[model samples]
Target: MPQMSPLSWLILFMVFTLSYLGFLTMNYFSTFYSSKTPSQININSTSHSWKW
Candidate 1:
């Protein structure tokens, strides 16, 4: 088999890193939002009750 050029190797590395970062970012946001929603709902209810 033929060897890959340096540019091709660089491109492949960049694509892999970017995809991995994207996946991590997506997972982080999903977990963050999931944890945040309950607190937000509680805050909203508390604020609404305080208004009365």
Candidate 2:
């Protein structure tokens, strides 16, 4: 079995945390934009229907 140095452990932890945060951020923005687009489409449809 091999033991890792403190610095190596620290780097690994940092990389994992950063990747996790990035994934969460991407997921959040995707959901946020998806919701926004649907609402905008609904609004546009309503406005167009009203004009007729």
Candidate 3:
């Protein structure tokens, strides 16, 4: 078997870290929004959060 260098190990660690962070962030945001009431409960556009 071939021995892996330190540089290769570092690169692998960084890739794994970034992907894990992204997965966690998505889960957190989804859970947060799912528990909130709809922001469009007010039919009036002037009172809506998406006012143009």
Candidate 4:
């Protein structure tokens, strides 16, 4: 088999690294992010299912 050059190896590593980072970034943001703020949540709401 033929040996790979340093430049070729560097390019390959960069491509793979960038692609992997991009994949992880995509997965990190794949979840549903809510835009609700503190004011949107009701403090006195009786939505709790537990009783004291």
Off by over 4 Å in 2: 1-4, 33-52
Q: Which lDDT tens digits does candidate 1 get at residues 1-52?
A: 2466877889999999999999999998787434556546654334433554
**C-alpha lDDT of candidate 1 relative to the true structure:** 0.77
> How do all the candidates rank in terms of TM-score, highest first?
4, 2, 1, 3
Clashing pairs in 4: none
RMSD of each: 7.9, 9.0, 7.8, 4.6
- Candidate 3: residue 44 lDDT (0-100): 57
Q: What lDDT tens digits, residue by residue, belong to model 3 across residues 1-52? A: 2366777889999999999999999998777443546884656557646767
Model 2, 1-52: lDDT tens digits are: 2376877889999999999999999998787433456545644334434554
Considering lDDT, which of the candidate structures 1 and 3 is the better prediction for this target?
3
Q: Which is the winner by TM-score between candidate 3 and candidate 4?
A: 4
Give the Å shift of residue 51 in candidate 2.
Answer: 44
lDDT of every predicted structure (CA atoms): 0.77, 0.76, 0.79, 0.89
**Can you list the residue pairs that collide in candidate 1?**
none
Find the 10 residues in a row with the least total lDDT in model 1: 43-52
Q: In candidate 3, which residue ranges exceed 4 Å CA deviation?
A: 1-4, 33-52
Please report how far candidate 3 places residue 8 from its true position, in Å. Answer: 0.7
**Per-residue C-alpha lDDT of model 4 across residues 1-52, encoded as one tens digit per residue:** 2366877889999999999999999999997888999989878856867887
